[model samples]
Target: MPKVSRRAVLALSAAAPLTLPAIARAAGPADAKFEALAKGWVDANLRLNPVGATQVGDHRFDDQIDDMGPTGRAAIIKLATETLAALQATPRAELSRANQVDAAILENQVRSDLWTLQALQPYAWDPLTWNAVAGGALYNLTAREFAPLDVRLRSATARMQKLPALLAQARQELVPARVPKIHADTVVGQNKGLHSLVDGIVADGAKLAPADRARLEAAAKTCKAAIDEHQTWLETVLVPGAKGEFRLGAALYDAKLAFALNSPLSRAEIKARALAEMTSLRATMYDISARFLAGKPGAPPTPARPTDAQRQAAIEAALEYAYAQKPARDKLVEAAEATLVEATAFVRARNIVTVPKDPVKIGLVPEFQRGVAVAYCDAPGPLDKGQQTYYKISPIPDDWTAAQADSFLREYNSLGIQEVTVHEAMPGHYLQLAHANAYPSVLRAVLSSGPFVEGWACYAQDVMADEGYLDRDPLYLLVHLKLQLRVCANALLDQAVHVDNISRDEAMKLMTVQAFQQEREAAGKWVRAQLSQAQLPTYFVGWEEHKALRKQAEAKWSKSFTLKRYHDGILSFGSPPARFAGQLLFDLPIA
Candidate 1:
């Protein structure tokens, strides 16, 4: 069989790539058959989501926009159903270990796609679905330097010209009454940011080839017009009428959680574990705090066995030491960059892992992508030649009041930011994903598990704290535990809002009091939980699984177990779910 170039896949008919080949349906070698199905699925998905294809380094489909209209969606459903059936028919027992894991990933991805399109149709209700597509479409194309400026601008022009149709589909497909008001409200601001992206492309187009620049110039008008119209519909129409429930309830939350996590933990199991960990982490926080706060002025007594009030007061007092060390309002990026250097140096000194040398740059999160999370690690596509992964931090908006910024800074204080820097940059997402991208399996790279990615990042934070990254600073240790509490609280808040119908007051208390989060952080999280479902638990769930896997490895490997060896061993398998990675690492059964 010859290798199919990405361009060739798109050049062939856009709609035909999704159809299952005879080989996928009629298997010979199980691995070979699975590979064929996987190829078809990837090609089909790239065609179905052209903008996403660009993000993943397959720029062949960059000129095309996703066809999310009814017929287009039907084709996607057909592809998923066929690919799933073919996958189910394949003999998993006959496949190699790597193939078995890839097969599991493929099946889960296909099923999740089916569930999203079939049962949990966000297209009908979640305006963020369309907003994300509309926003990411241009940003992904323009943000990365995967190709030449002239070429990228030309593709950007093509996508820009087609914006109206996509927005029209959004307005047509979205049932106004079913849209969540929070989602609708959030997207209005996001949609407003589309014009900024357009202006960026247009500004960059000034350097394009004359003809290409002219096309981009024209498309900019079309794109901006469509965004304005879409903004109107979002603000005046959908938002006012959005009366839908934000909660997934038990049934839908359970289903989404399974797919989102790819873990064995149930919703109830996750809630129980998170709450328990919350208690444990707070106790540890108190223990760490007792070292700093014992006999301090106005501090609660830190007895060998303190009461809840004593523990809480002591922990609160210790956190103030960290809070007082926050960066100036404008210095977050500078501080994080310095922290990254310190962390990277610490990792090297400790020999904790085979730290990859791929460049990790820090920048501000794009305006359109703000309001969801504070920071993210955006790596280049596995196929892209560039190795620069952006560790983007969301800048404080100019409109924010002094009090809001103060609260935010206090929550993300200096030590807390160091913990986050460890999570998002050096020896965390950037370090781990550099290794993941280098792994030979493209299938695994493309469908990498969120749990594994997040788990590794969280585990990296724990590793640093354990290794005395900042020289056993009790203040840093306390901040790490409080942030850890937030991770656990996230799982609780995720389920609480979506399943338990927890009120705003209750949710705020959970974060601000129980989790020791500041008011600004708590308020932002309340909005985040509503906007995102089944996602918050990945940090906690993956953190626990990664930790457990390390324990098992330590006991199994005995004298052979080393932090660098174990870390490199697990990451070598690419970012599969922790269980699958553990099985591969331990040479256990793939099942």
Candidate 2:
């Protein structure tokens, strides 16, 4: 979450006058109180989580790092509990439709935060939480040019001075007996990269006056020494004793999934839907496979129901054709750049949803932020709407064996790269978020839902394929179906790992055989699934909601529907849950 500037918040408050609509103006007192509480919560959150504030372009807190010790955690818990109570006190029936929806979203957010603090309690076990805070405190200050070099450097130095305290607090807070081995290993790797903040960015890039430069250099040296010491402590002291369980089990998984999805569906229902979709999607892939292999020796007829082995063989053949077109390891960035241009032109020529003029840059993933997903769409904080958006792609690590690199490249081949470009840029995250930032509600923008964000990206892939993107090339369509298979597999893998205690062998078989994923990709996902839970399911769950919402709109509008209009209409509201967007679009009652 990002922080809004005081000027923007004031501007919104003055222009909109947060009150009930004409129909429910009699409930003005309740509406006004609820609005005040929402504003207060945002302000408090920013103040407490200063690194988050800086990421969202709020510089006031740039000089400080958050305190994650017991005292700090208690404050956060108190804030969420009290805010939730205040929201509940307001009568939902008296508010206007939009306000009612806002109240519900805020209520859910409060509960989610509380659950994270009280139940999940990552602070006691997850080292990555602390690692991110330390890295982001420096990364956010240096990565963007939102301020003058000297000013940002001064802030950076201040934050650097606090590194010892933050790291010391982490040493006190983390429970050695409860740390997971994988998480400890990941933090050990990540801590080594944190020095890049000083060596790469501050030392080389920060052009400071002689005196200030001397101070910054001293601070940088201190920070580097502290990090190196911490890394040693982590490897020698922490890793040896780490024995925490990664699985959340059935009860905790259910609670986390409900909050993460923010949908009305149960865990059982989501699993059932994903299983059905997986079977149907595999059937479609077989059809394409049969067509693709029609001329080959020993090929099954297009109309024949090929045996499972035959279907797998045909799909592998098609994948070989796709993999043959992969970019050289050195040329991956260049390929993504070229694909972005082609995808942008195709979307415009087809009159797909209007593309905003906001600029997006393609760059290598920063060293500190790697070890997660391969690529991400890093949009500007909603508060800073016009800043540059980054589509960060990770290169294969130089230390990897040749076999590992080859497997990674095979999965991210030319067609796979194009599909990623479409999802991250063009008609996907970049364009949708531009419209989201422009939405009139600052509150909604700040509290944007994950499902809506991830779902829109997945839905965009389907639209591109359906509209004959890349000239309807079967190879391109083949990759699209394969990507969908990966998405469906994600939901299954997420649940199976956390709730069912699925082993590595089982997960590998599911990915390699069922979804046709490469060994390197499956291995990375296995590590990620352990590091986090409930998030991987968002792509599948959100895509389902977006698909259902589109169908509902098409039925309601009948002869009047246009893809562009439907796309734009759904994005017009800030990135709320799909159910709320549906309510707004079809004039249905708000839940």
Candidate 3:
């Protein structure tokens, strides 16, 4: 594993003081100081991370390239360090409790980021970042529709300018001595895609306005050079060094785990927890499957131990069935709209909480942004003034086999589709983000935690289940369980592959044999695990935390716990990690 920098460790390890200075309380013309600083922080942060900025709906730096070299790294550290100082200088008493928490979370995030940037040094040779860039560029093409062509061109140009330098840095930083074979192979596939983006998108400077064409042409040249350099570096350096182990070594893994989770649970502790939960979930699946699908009256529960070949065949069959049953593209959109209506009625009739007035639209994934997560909810930034939310779905491949299409459709059948709609459209990602966007503080929104974001979405599955949807449908229940299992499996994969020496075969068995996934699904999971960290675990963890918080809040409020009151109160705290929510709701001091 790569070693984290001493500087990063120091920044995160320091204890933050409890209160802000007196001058921070002065409500003069400088009262907007924090707000100004937040914007600046956002700008610098986004400029250094253009891909993120594009995701966040910022187009100003769309075409800019961040160095990500030692100099670039130093700038990031400085920004984080300074941001912390500004936060510390603010008087906490003057700010609302919500802002205070936001400040604290931001401070922690800055420190955490600094630590990861310097210490683990993920940028040097991390396959996750590389493949994401390669893949993310395609994804962005779909997203660029909302922006004017000129705006998109500018953004592309900026990114193109930085590509060569960035790739050069990648070549230097990626230590070929430790590259993993699985990751290297994945990158090989990704590199082909990267070249496509360059040739088809970045290299197409003629599409820009006359004024923008020259700059884009120059950027294209640079991008072409960088792409070639990185390609060579991958072939000669990183590829040769691609060993098979996934772990980032013991110490760095431990540190990353602590910061990512914001808890003291060791990898082993998390694994134990996941395993226990998986056992209970498996038993629950048996009961539920038997109760709902008792056609044979006493048939055994669905088996998990499908042999590799068997699993592949079963999944292929499932996919075939799915495609056969799927609606036409337009009908698919209609179904989603209908499901959203039903979900809204369900929530409203139950009077459980507030629903955002924001209009939600379901759309197909655009050509450029093809290989991001299968589906993602693109909500407006928290600081944005509008209420538009987009639920983007990837279209099935044009050449998908009839059987393959069926299996895919089955995985997202009517009940399963409703579950997704509840989570991503009417009341899941759309609703949560709508409320979070209304949060008074900018810092919290800018630095939102992944666990909180994903956890809320996962929790919505059960929330809808409890509220009633295709009530007691066996397949529906199976879908939910499968999703939850993905979360649990994520924690296991991170721990097993990285912390322990779990092989690809073992990982395949875990998902296919233990969790009952298909081969294609299992292979996809393997790629995802290697490419990201501290994310897959969030769905389950977030669900766990959200459940616990709601339970505690319900108990505390008792008779006073109106659904709206509880929900409004919960969301009013902004979008910090639910752990932070636990502290704020209970009036407990920061842990």
Candidate 4:
């Protein structure tokens, strides 16, 4: 549950914004100004966050890590404030529709970053900020093949040499009193694993000349020692006195939630909708459950408004079928690779959506990247669309006891793995993002919306189910419903944990009992919920937005609307917020 820093989140979703190719037609003055501002912002942002630049396939800043000290932070804040003013000063009415949308997104991005620095102030309190910065800086160079092995190794050595200074700055800036206990604990565990990135991945992968190899080995050894020293300091000095409040309180949570969601719905509205959906989705699960356990002797009849115990019993009974087909502990990655092939074949046969031809590979999640979610879709950056996309799955840690590993495998059983593959690879993130990269506007690709990106994946899961994937097997459909329940629970869990002072016991009950997550999965989510705010809710929020958009398209087009056509048209605009996508699709004016 490391703090996902601004740069890390940007790397995960939006990459560096490159300029659009110009057309032969004459341009309006405001359009020209907007285009120039877009390029300037991208360049300045990359300079400030070189690790982010590397993640997005920009090799220009490959040798540098970000400066995280007070002066460095102040410079970014000043730039954001000035840029916000400039964006506001430009007349939105004079720009083209596309430029107008970009202006809105840029303004929000600048304002959000300013809020994070000035109000949230995570750099001073969150130790995970430093941990992620160090991990990402190295991961970018080692994990991808964007450059020659020797060249990448050289960049890695330079970044490794800078680690001591970075760690020293972190030691100076962090205030023990403000460090949250959970964040401190998470970093303490994570710091122990950072060295593995250098020792295991980088050194093994990079084939350098003897002198350069020796230089890298030396720098990496020094970097590991610095990390060890920092860990000791954090445990002995920081954790003992750390008493910071983790709750954002209602006010801060509300503000941060707005920026995170980027939707018109207020916090209260989202909560209400989430609660309603939870009830509705449970009923659907029950219906599917009844069908799944139709002939079972001990199965209880599905109730109209089942009590908590009855709902749990029926859902668990249905899940037993899926859990029986769990993957072997050692074969998680192998199973996912096989699932990807099946998912791709299904998408192609059904003509559900246009599958992208970009190559995708499954890999074990790196040590530094673990302790967050179990898996993620690492699409090639927009600038590097020709490269590979990774569906990274975290294996059960070797340190886990037998029971812990078994619990994890049961939760991510065979059906669960296939469901995840469908969401992360074929006709989900991989397919959608490939289309997103092909989008004509670089500005749009760089400012992609989380809800749109996540929502499409969620939508794809449902579409696959509806199109009779797995031959419409009731077990597969039941797993789909169970996953949907998790999505709904996420919306509730995120708000409750941050704004409502939810305790670990309460959060665990919500995830395990209410959502039917395994004990290990629930525990991991408790940590993730603490590390992030307004993020868990995206899957549900985005799915709802996509559902509404599809309904609108159906009504507007009448007989002409097809799923494939609607999907392609929606993805063509890149990944904007759902509201903007709606406006763009139907030719509605940009607000």
lDDT of 2 by residue, 386-416 (tens): 4667777988999999899899988999999
Model 3, backbone clash pairs (residues 3+ apart or across chains), number: 26
Q: Model 3, range 423-476, lDDT digits (tens) per residue?
A: 776556666666665554555666665666667777777777766666655556
lDDT to native, each model: 0.82, 0.80, 0.63, 0.81
- Displacement of residue 415 (Cα, Å) in model 3 is 3.1
- Candidate 1 matches the true fold with a TM-score of 0.94
**Model 1 segments more than 4 A misplaced:** 1-28
Score every model by TM-score: 0.94, 0.94, 0.79, 0.95
Each model's Cα RMSD: 5.8, 4.0, 7.2, 2.8
For model 2, the superposed segments whose C-alpha errors exceed 4 Å read 1-27, 204-206, 297-303
Error of 3 at 294 (Å): 3.3
Candidate achieving higher lDDT, 1 or 4: 1
**Clash count (model 1, backbone only):** 0
